[model samples]
Target chain A: MTALPASTPRKMGLVIDLDTCVGCHACVTACKGWNTENYGAPLSDTDAYGADPVGTFLNRVHSYEVTPAEGTPFTVHFPKSCLHCEDAPCVTVCPTGASYKRAEDGIVLVNEDHCIGCGLCAWACPYGARELDAVAGVMKKCTLCVDRIYNETLPEVDRLPACVRTCPAGARHFGDLADPGSAVSRLVAERGGMDLMPEQGTRPVNKYLPPRPRDALTATPAATPADPSTEGLGGFLGWIDRTLARF
Target chain B: MHPAPSIILFTTISGLGLGLLAFLGIGMIEPTGLAAFLWFTLGYGLTLVGLASSAFHLGHPERALRAFTQWRTSWLSREAVLAAVAMLVLAPHAIGLIFFNRPLTGFGIIGGLLALQTVLATSMIYGQLRTVPRWNHWTTPTLFLISAITGGALLSGLPFLSQMLLAWLAVAMVLHWILGDSRFAASGSTLGSATGLGARGAVRQLEPPHTGTNYLLREMAYVVARRHVVPLRLIALLAACVLPSVLLWIAPFSLPAIAAAILLHILGMLTARWLFFAQAEHVVGLYYGVR
Candidate 1:
């Protein structure tokens, strides 16, 4: 049961735009809130008010500074979560049949009931997407909001993943990546989206659109501004200017 | 690669125990009655103790029985199954020697092979992890198997075999360290590649995901002291291979010498195992620029 499906009917995943993310961590908060309340286990925090607080989260945001060969350096906000790879090593390495990848949607999920909490799946992940809940004693991961994606109870507009729906920058997009004609696929094709650590051979369903090139100041001379006229002879100002002129 | 004490003890102690059991099963030390009982008890005791310590590393040790169900793909599951089967097969041979003074060659051979395979399976658990570039190699398994064999040969009182294997193990240990040192660089993983920002130029982490440590950082992005690495490697090699080899060469059958050799050997192995986990560089560290 831990073996990955040969192929999925639809690769439901995210296409994150690095150029648009503002590093506000809104998506991270939204994901934490929705998943803690609705998903397998409530993402518990140990010593919430103490000096050191450690908690399990399904998503996180990181910021990096990129220095170009010919342009100025700039910061890029990076939000990371489970990419739900087609060849997910995390699922297969599980000793218990707890972690699994869905053949229907290609979403990787963990069955808390079956998990032994060996943390091997977390070790297997290259992206650090899996986390072991300290209180729940089970592995936790991004489910891609499996409960909400197909839910008919909520309005159609509110059916998206909490992260995507709440991202203030509209940096995250979700759809079937398996379909070449899907909006997510089209966006990937148009923006030259890339897979993180492609050499890892995970074949991640989610793609990241690289940050666009930023404009730098050109090395050209600019016209000088007109000299300030000392025509307004204020009492103190005029005396100071005249005294300096004597030198 | 945090190098948890429970894991270090589990791997090193179990490897040594399994190694000794393999030798005992093959009739390397022909003892009967009380002697056979003592040796078999020591072997089983060490193996069980090592295994029991590993349970503490698990978040839910009570559900460990479920681990046996996934041998089809998981190496950890295969290790559990192989270790259990090995012990079961060796049980009858051990009983025969202790009660009937008969060495069951057929059962012994089968059990010996299974016990050795359990060491291989144990090694594969770490080797199979591609995320840790330093461990994802054939050398990882080779190192583990060699250590187990050498430790087993020494414990079996085979002087010539112990000396030879110790020399070989020394070479293997040095070679493994040298190769492991370059694995992360050779892995072609960088901050640029991890972030998919290589084309723009060099990528460096400006800020981590959180101000406080998280599970990923605590578990994978460990940073061992660089200054202590060389001295520790020296200590491990000296204690594990060099001193033990000298003792065997000088006094092939002295009781105190064998006792000292085993003690030094275990100490050396513990150091080496600790280094094995601590030195490993997981690819995920690139994301935080930890390496």
Candidate 2:
């Protein structure tokens, strides 16, 4: 085998634009569709198209209507999923070494064959990312499309995850987070992006740009039409006239 | 803390086994009816077998012997030792009931001690897990105590309080589940104790460590949705505690009620055990970038 040149570490992640996302759930659907097919086991539903259906979904969007300090009403659709943390507690708690992070690209993954179905990783997570495949007796979660992103068969532009590709509003961006010049890094730097539950200390790489102010995006509401007769008439005759006009 | 089924089976089975043995020894001193003795013995024997079978779920069964070595520090080890002691005492006590016309005064005392030890050891298993804030409380011990007392009481009063015990168990399970989710403000001793940066505000994530799921996320990130949690909690309460209690209360002295009580107590104890693991919050939650 030809020896390749030693390379420095690379940090890969996603930057999601909260301002532009329309809460379409396309990314959620794309993620579920891709992961259900590729992950350790299919995210099977016990009673799909029936009462009380249950299954694993890798990504979900939460829409919250925020009335800020200024008292302006605006809706912010927050798409929540696994924020792959640097100090992942899930990996440390696994009695089996099935849960591990890659040193090369900072991608954390589970070796399904090594998993003993202990569900320890499920207990160690706080973001509700991992789910147990009760049928296969193993754990499952989002891979960020590890297979597609690294595949040489796909074009460079199409290397992003299915979730990123399917986002209709261009809210999701995937790239090397370590490079200061990368689009994600620059966007995070410029927009003051935030991570969900940062106090969790998992050091999640995904960034969520805060929603833009309501006034900055929408026009003010116009004044309501006035009742012209109300100001002019005050007596019984005016009431009679108004009643006649109503008839 | 999703209660792994193996663990649920282990704790519940063992709890009933130890609990029934304790009551059987108590009944010997006071001379309860022959029916009570029969039911208690049956409950204890069944639970013993169930607990033994649960040993198969462990990763290293042969090394289970090594588990006894950690009695000074490990509740699990203590539980094993106490279980063995209970078995020893119950064997002689059962023999006396069957063959020897002699009363079980001596063996009963030993059985009581063994039962107490089992309950304490079981409580300590969860109480000792400092990483899990929910399991680390006095409530854990109280829950274990309640399981033992209620299980024993049901077995002792068989055909009478079986339903009531089951109902109490159901209510206890609901309370346990609710308490499991309510977030206590970070105190000086718990998950918040690590940072000591008491700002008295909710901590939101500013950044996370990586872009992919790791072991901590996989283990700790499992969440029971609001919709499912309520119904499951109710089912666990009804099947495990409430229904049994009602059946036992209305039809006390009935063999079917006694049977139902034993079955429901076991089921409730298992649900309670599952919730015990599921609701626990680890100190590692501190490292998840939370305050």
Q: TM-score per candidate, in order?
A: 0.96, 0.56
Candidate 2, which segments miss by more than 4 Å at Cα?
Answer: A1-8, A216-230, A233-247, B1-7, B14-291
Model 2 clash tally, residue pairs: 52
Q: Write the per-residue lDDT of candidate 1 for residues B132-172, one digit (tens) a residue.
A: 98899888999999998888888777888999999999988
Candidate 1 Cα misplacement greater than 4 A, ranges? A216-242, A245-247
Query: What DockQ does predicted model 1 obtain?
Result: 0.80
Each model's RMSD to truth, in Å?
2.7, 11.0
Clashing pairs in 1: none
| Residue B290 lDDT (model 1) | 89
Best by DockQ: 1
Two-chain complex of model 2, DockQ on C-alpha atoms against the true structure: 0.03
lDDT, candidate 1, A165-232, per-residue tens: 99999999999999999999999999999999988889999999998767667765586669866766
lDDT digits (tens) for residues B194-241 of candidate 2: 322122223233334333443454455344543366666666677767
Cand. 1 TM to true fold: 0.96
